[model samples]
Target: MENDQQQKLISELVFLIEKGNAHVSMEDAVAGLPANMRTVIPENLPYSIWQLIEHIRIAQKDILDFCVSEDHEKLAWPDDYWTEPVEHIDDQTWENALNEIKQERQRFFDLLQDEKTDLFSPIEWGDGQTILCEAMLIADHNAYHTAEIVVIRRMLGCWR
Candidate 1:
Protein backbone atom coordinates (compact mmCIF):
# COMPACT_ATOMS: atom_id res chain seq x y z
CA MET A 1 0.00 0.00 0.00
CA GLU A 2 1.11 3.56 -0.52
CA ASN A 3 2.56 5.31 2.52
CA ASP A 4 -0.15 7.95 2.41
CA GLN A 5 -2.92 5.38 2.25
CA GLN A 6 -1.41 3.34 5.07
CA GLN A 7 -1.08 6.42 7.26
CA LYS A 8 -4.66 7.40 6.52
CA LEU A 9 -5.86 3.94 7.36
CA ILE A 10 -3.99 3.95 10.66
CA SER A 11 -5.45 7.31 11.62
CA GLU A 12 -8.94 6.12 10.78
CA LEU A 13 -8.56 2.89 12.68
CA VAL A 14 -7.29 4.70 15.73
CA PHE A 15 -10.26 7.04 15.61
CA LEU A 16 -12.64 4.13 15.15
CA ILE A 17 -11.27 2.31 18.16
CA GLU A 18 -10.85 5.26 20.51
CA LYS A 19 -13.23 7.99 19.42
CA GLY A 20 -16.28 5.77 18.87
CA ASN A 21 -17.05 7.91 15.80
CA ALA A 22 -20.54 6.45 15.39
CA HIS A 23 -21.50 6.06 19.07
CA VAL A 24 -20.44 6.75 22.66
CA SER A 25 -16.90 5.92 23.57
CA MET A 26 -16.44 3.22 26.19
CA GLU A 27 -15.13 5.69 28.73
CA ASP A 28 -17.99 8.08 28.20
CA ALA A 29 -20.55 5.29 28.48
CA VAL A 30 -19.16 4.37 31.89
CA ALA A 31 -18.41 7.89 33.04
CA GLY A 32 -20.36 9.33 36.01
CA LEU A 33 -21.89 5.93 36.76
CA PRO A 34 -22.57 5.53 40.45
CA ALA A 35 -20.46 2.94 42.20
CA ASN A 36 -23.55 1.08 43.39
CA MET A 37 -25.11 1.14 39.95
CA ARG A 38 -22.10 -0.49 38.36
CA THR A 39 -23.08 -3.85 39.81
CA VAL A 40 -26.82 -3.53 39.38
CA ILE A 41 -28.19 -5.89 36.76
CA PRO A 42 -31.03 -4.35 34.85
CA GLU A 43 -34.18 -6.42 34.44
CA ASN A 44 -34.05 -8.85 31.51
CA LEU A 45 -30.42 -8.03 30.82
CA PRO A 46 -27.86 -10.78 31.21
CA TYR A 47 -25.08 -8.54 32.58
CA SER A 48 -24.26 -5.55 34.74
CA ILE A 49 -22.06 -2.57 33.83
CA TRP A 50 -19.23 -4.19 35.72
CA GLN A 51 -19.63 -7.42 33.78
CA LEU A 52 -19.74 -5.57 30.49
CA ILE A 53 -16.59 -3.59 31.23
CA GLU A 54 -14.77 -6.71 32.31
CA HIS A 55 -15.86 -8.49 29.16
CA ILE A 56 -14.55 -5.62 27.07
CA ARG A 57 -11.28 -5.67 28.96
CA ILE A 58 -10.76 -9.42 28.62
CA ALA A 59 -11.66 -9.58 24.97
CA GLN A 60 -9.59 -6.51 24.07
CA LYS A 61 -6.57 -7.86 25.89
CA ASP A 62 -6.95 -11.25 24.25
CA ILE A 63 -7.07 -9.71 20.79
CA LEU A 64 -4.11 -7.48 21.57
CA ASP A 65 -2.10 -10.47 22.69
CA PHE A 66 -3.06 -12.39 19.57
CA CYS A 67 -1.90 -9.55 17.34
CA VAL A 68 1.40 -8.92 19.14
CA SER A 69 2.43 -12.42 20.22
CA GLU A 70 2.95 -15.60 18.26
CA ASP A 71 2.25 -17.82 21.26
CA HIS A 72 -0.99 -16.19 22.31
CA GLU A 73 -3.42 -18.72 23.71
CA LYS A 74 -6.95 -18.49 22.44
CA LEU A 75 -9.54 -17.98 25.18
CA ALA A 76 -12.71 -20.08 25.28
CA TRP A 77 -15.68 -18.25 23.84
CA PRO A 78 -18.36 -16.80 26.23
CA ASP A 79 -16.63 -18.42 29.24
CA ASP A 80 -13.20 -16.82 29.38
CA TYR A 81 -14.47 -13.64 27.76
CA TRP A 82 -17.07 -12.74 30.39
CA THR A 83 -16.26 -12.23 34.04
CA GLU A 84 -17.90 -14.28 36.79
CA PRO A 85 -21.16 -12.58 37.78
CA VAL A 86 -20.32 -10.00 40.44
CA GLU A 87 -22.69 -8.15 42.71
CA HIS A 88 -20.11 -5.72 44.03
CA ILE A 89 -16.80 -4.08 43.13
CA ASP A 90 -14.55 -1.75 45.08
CA ASP A 91 -13.47 1.56 43.62
CA GLN A 92 -9.90 0.38 43.22
CA THR A 93 -10.92 -2.76 41.32
CA TRP A 94 -13.18 -0.80 39.03
CA GLU A 95 -10.50 1.77 38.32
CA ASN A 96 -7.93 -0.94 37.68
CA ALA A 97 -10.09 -2.71 35.12
CA LEU A 98 -10.84 0.53 33.31
CA ASN A 99 -7.16 1.43 33.28
CA GLU A 100 -6.28 -1.98 31.88
CA ILE A 101 -8.69 -1.45 29.02
CA LYS A 102 -7.12 1.88 28.17
CA GLN A 103 -3.64 0.44 28.37
CA GLU A 104 -4.47 -2.51 26.12
CA ARG A 105 -6.15 -0.22 23.65
CA GLN A 106 -3.15 2.11 23.58
CA ARG A 107 -0.94 -0.86 22.82
CA PHE A 108 -3.12 -1.69 19.86
CA PHE A 109 -2.87 1.89 18.66
CA ASP A 110 0.87 1.68 18.94
CA LEU A 111 0.86 -1.44 16.79
CA LEU A 112 -1.15 0.36 14.20
CA GLN A 113 1.14 3.37 14.30
CA ASP A 114 4.25 1.33 13.72
CA GLU A 115 5.33 1.91 10.16
CA LYS A 116 6.77 -1.59 9.85
CA THR A 117 3.63 -3.39 11.01
CA ASP A 118 1.89 -4.77 7.96
CA LEU A 119 -1.82 -4.30 8.43
CA PHE A 120 -2.91 -6.55 5.59
CA SER A 121 -0.51 -9.47 5.76
CA PRO A 122 -1.90 -12.71 7.17
CA ILE A 123 -0.72 -13.58 10.64
CA GLU A 124 1.73 -16.41 10.39
CA TRP A 125 0.46 -18.54 13.26
CA GLY A 126 -3.22 -18.22 12.45
CA ASP A 127 -5.35 -19.76 9.72
CA GLY A 128 -5.67 -16.52 7.76
CA GLN A 129 -6.02 -13.46 9.95
CA THR A 130 -4.48 -10.03 9.57
CA ILE A 131 -3.87 -7.07 11.80
CA LEU A 132 -6.52 -5.24 9.84
CA CYS A 133 -9.04 -7.95 10.65
CA GLU A 134 -8.15 -7.89 14.31
CA ALA A 135 -8.42 -4.12 14.42
CA MET A 136 -11.93 -4.22 12.99
CA LEU A 137 -12.89 -6.95 15.42
CA ILE A 138 -11.73 -4.91 18.38
CA ALA A 139 -13.53 -1.78 17.25
CA ASP A 140 -16.76 -3.59 16.41
CA HIS A 141 -16.76 -5.68 19.57
CA ASN A 142 -16.07 -2.75 21.86
CA ALA A 143 -18.64 -0.53 20.18
CA TYR A 144 -21.32 -3.22 20.52
CA HIS A 145 -20.64 -3.65 24.23
CA THR A 146 -20.41 0.08 24.78
CA ALA A 147 -23.87 0.45 23.29
CA GLU A 148 -25.12 -2.28 25.60
CA ILE A 149 -23.69 -0.43 28.56
CA VAL A 150 -25.49 2.71 27.49
CA VAL A 151 -28.72 0.78 27.10
CA ILE A 152 -28.35 -0.69 30.57
CA ARG A 153 -27.73 2.78 31.96
CA ARG A 154 -30.91 4.00 30.30
CA MET A 155 -32.85 1.04 31.62
CA LEU A 156 -31.65 1.76 35.15
CA GLY A 157 -32.66 5.41 34.84
CA CYS A 158 -29.08 6.54 35.15
CA TRP A 159 -28.38 7.81 31.66
CA ARG A 160 -28.52 11.53 31.05
Candidate 2:
Protein backbone atom coordinates (compact mmCIF):
# COMPACT_ATOMS: atom_id res chain seq x y z
CA MET A 1 0.00 0.00 0.00
CA GLU A 2 1.28 3.46 -0.93
CA ASN A 3 1.75 5.72 2.06
CA ASP A 4 0.21 9.16 2.28
CA GLN A 5 3.53 10.90 1.62
CA GLN A 6 4.26 8.89 -1.52
CA GLN A 7 0.78 9.43 -2.92
CA LYS A 8 0.93 13.14 -2.15
CA LEU A 9 4.30 13.44 -3.84
CA ILE A 10 3.05 11.74 -6.96
CA SER A 11 -0.05 13.89 -7.06
CA GLU A 12 1.87 17.12 -6.67
CA LEU A 13 4.44 16.12 -9.25
CA VAL A 14 1.76 15.28 -11.79
CA PHE A 15 -0.03 18.54 -11.18
CA LEU A 16 3.16 20.51 -11.60
CA ILE A 17 4.07 18.66 -14.78
CA GLU A 18 0.68 19.01 -16.43
CA LYS A 19 -0.94 22.17 -15.06
CA GLY A 20 1.85 24.51 -13.95
CA ASN A 21 0.32 25.56 -10.62
CA ALA A 22 2.09 28.94 -10.25
CA HIS A 23 3.40 29.66 -13.74
CA VAL A 24 2.15 29.39 -17.30
CA SER A 25 1.69 25.93 -18.70
CA MET A 26 3.60 24.83 -21.80
CA GLU A 27 0.37 24.66 -23.81
CA ASP A 28 -0.55 28.17 -22.74
CA ALA A 29 2.90 29.52 -23.55
CA VAL A 30 2.99 28.13 -27.07
CA ALA A 31 -0.63 28.64 -27.96
CA GLY A 32 -1.47 31.20 -30.64
CA LEU A 33 2.19 32.07 -31.33
CA PRO A 34 2.67 33.10 -34.95
CA ALA A 35 5.12 31.10 -36.97
CA ASN A 36 7.15 34.14 -37.96
CA MET A 37 7.45 35.32 -34.37
CA ARG A 38 8.86 32.03 -33.12
CA THR A 39 12.38 32.73 -34.40
CA VAL A 40 12.41 36.42 -33.56
CA ILE A 41 14.90 37.35 -30.85
CA PRO A 42 13.50 40.09 -28.68
CA GLU A 43 15.78 42.98 -27.82
CA ASN A 44 18.58 42.07 -25.36
CA LEU A 45 17.43 38.46 -25.18
CA PRO A 46 19.95 35.80 -26.25
CA TYR A 47 17.48 33.18 -27.42
CA SER A 48 14.31 33.33 -29.47
CA ILE A 49 11.10 31.70 -28.26
CA TRP A 50 11.55 28.84 -30.72
CA GLN A 51 15.08 28.25 -29.55
CA LEU A 52 13.92 28.03 -25.97
CA ILE A 53 11.15 25.65 -26.94
CA GLU A 54 13.59 23.46 -28.81
CA HIS A 55 16.00 23.56 -25.91
CA ILE A 56 13.30 22.49 -23.50
CA ARG A 57 12.25 19.68 -25.78
CA ILE A 58 15.82 18.49 -26.27
CA ALA A 59 16.64 18.64 -22.60
CA GLN A 60 13.43 16.93 -21.53
CA LYS A 61 13.95 14.20 -24.11
CA ASP A 62 17.51 13.73 -22.92
CA ILE A 63 16.39 13.34 -19.33
CA LEU A 64 13.67 10.92 -20.32
CA ASP A 65 16.16 8.91 -22.34
CA PHE A 66 18.58 8.87 -19.45
CA CYS A 67 15.88 7.55 -17.16
CA VAL A 68 14.92 4.71 -19.48
CA SER A 69 17.90 3.85 -21.64
CA GLU A 70 20.74 1.86 -20.14
CA ASP A 71 23.01 2.67 -23.08
CA HIS A 72 22.08 6.34 -23.43
CA GLU A 73 25.05 8.59 -24.11
CA LYS A 74 24.92 12.03 -22.57
CA LEU A 75 25.03 14.93 -24.99
CA ALA A 76 27.46 17.82 -24.67
CA TRP A 77 26.03 20.47 -22.41
CA PRO A 78 24.54 23.73 -23.88
CA ASP A 79 25.72 22.95 -27.41
CA ASP A 80 23.71 19.82 -28.16
CA TYR A 81 20.80 21.12 -26.13
CA TRP A 82 20.41 24.29 -28.23
CA THR A 83 19.81 24.93 -31.88
CA GLU A 84 21.62 27.36 -34.20
CA PRO A 85 19.95 30.70 -34.74
CA VAL A 86 17.64 30.71 -37.70
CA GLU A 87 16.27 33.60 -39.74
CA HIS A 88 12.79 32.15 -39.82
CA ILE A 89 10.88 29.13 -38.65
CA ASP A 90 8.11 27.69 -40.79
CA ASP A 91 4.74 26.56 -39.48
CA GLN A 92 5.60 22.91 -39.88
CA THR A 93 8.78 23.25 -37.85
CA TRP A 94 6.98 25.03 -35.04
CA GLU A 95 4.17 22.49 -35.04
CA ASN A 96 6.65 19.64 -35.01
CA ALA A 97 8.44 20.99 -31.99
CA LEU A 98 5.21 21.48 -30.10
CA ASN A 99 4.08 17.97 -31.03
CA GLU A 100 7.33 16.48 -29.85
CA ILE A 101 7.08 18.31 -26.55
CA LYS A 102 3.54 17.14 -26.01
CA GLN A 103 4.51 13.57 -26.76
CA GLU A 104 7.50 13.63 -24.44
CA ARG A 105 5.53 15.25 -21.66
CA GLN A 106 2.90 12.55 -22.00
CA ARG A 107 5.60 9.91 -21.80
CA PHE A 108 6.89 11.33 -18.54
CA PHE A 109 3.40 11.65 -17.18
CA ASP A 110 2.72 8.03 -17.98
CA LEU A 111 5.79 6.97 -16.08
CA LEU A 112 4.64 8.80 -13.01
CA GLN A 113 1.20 7.30 -13.31
CA ASP A 114 2.46 3.73 -13.53
CA GLU A 115 1.63 1.86 -10.32
CA LYS A 116 4.59 -0.48 -10.70
CA THR A 117 7.16 2.28 -11.16
CA ASP A 118 9.53 2.50 -8.22
CA LEU A 119 9.79 6.26 -7.90
CA PHE A 120 12.37 6.05 -5.12
CA SER A 121 14.56 3.40 -6.67
CA PRO A 122 17.77 4.53 -8.31
CA ILE A 123 17.93 4.14 -12.04
CA GLU A 124 20.70 1.72 -13.00
CA TRP A 125 22.22 4.12 -15.53
CA GLY A 126 21.84 7.26 -13.44
CA ASP A 127 24.10 8.39 -10.64
CA GLY A 128 21.92 7.32 -7.73
CA GLN A 129 19.03 9.40 -9.01
CA THR A 130 15.48 8.14 -8.57
CA ILE A 131 12.58 8.44 -10.99
CA LEU A 132 10.99 10.89 -8.61
CA CYS A 133 14.04 13.11 -8.91
CA GLU A 134 13.96 13.00 -12.72
CA ALA A 135 10.24 13.80 -12.79
CA MET A 136 10.69 16.81 -10.54
CA LEU A 137 13.75 17.93 -12.51
CA ILE A 138 11.80 17.87 -15.77
CA ALA A 139 8.88 19.67 -14.20
CA ASP A 140 11.10 22.39 -12.76
CA HIS A 141 13.17 22.72 -15.92
CA ASN A 142 10.11 22.92 -18.16
CA ALA A 143 8.46 25.45 -15.90
CA TYR A 144 11.58 27.64 -15.93
CA HIS A 145 11.87 27.65 -19.71
CA THR A 146 8.12 27.95 -20.23
CA ALA A 147 8.16 31.14 -18.21
CA GLU A 148 10.97 32.44 -20.41
CA ILE A 149 8.88 31.78 -23.47
CA VAL A 150 6.02 33.75 -21.93
CA VAL A 151 8.37 36.63 -21.21
CA ILE A 152 9.60 36.62 -24.78
CA ARG A 153 6.02 36.61 -26.03
CA ARG A 154 5.22 39.58 -23.86
CA MET A 155 8.29 41.40 -25.14
CA LEU A 156 7.18 40.81 -28.71
CA GLY A 157 3.60 41.74 -27.85
CA CYS A 158 2.57 38.42 -29.28
CA TRP A 159 1.05 36.85 -26.16
CA ARG A 160 -2.66 37.25 -25.87
Local accuracy of candidate 2 as per-residue lDDT tens digits, 59-96: 99999888878888789987999998899988888889
Q: List per-prediction Cα lDDT, in the order shown.
A: 0.93, 0.88
Tens digit per residue, CA lDDT, model 1, 27-118? 99999999999999888888899999999999999999999898888899989998877879999999999999999999999999998899
Q: Which ten residues in a row are the worst by lDDT in model 1?
A: 78-87
Q: Candidate 1: where is the Cα deviation over 4 Å?
A: none
Which candidate number maximizes TM-score?
1
Question: What TM-score does model 1 achieve against the real structure?
Answer: 0.97
What is candidate 2's local distance difference test score?
A: 0.88
Q: Worst lDDT window (10 residues) for model 2?
A: 1-10
Residue pairs with backbone overlap in model 1 = none
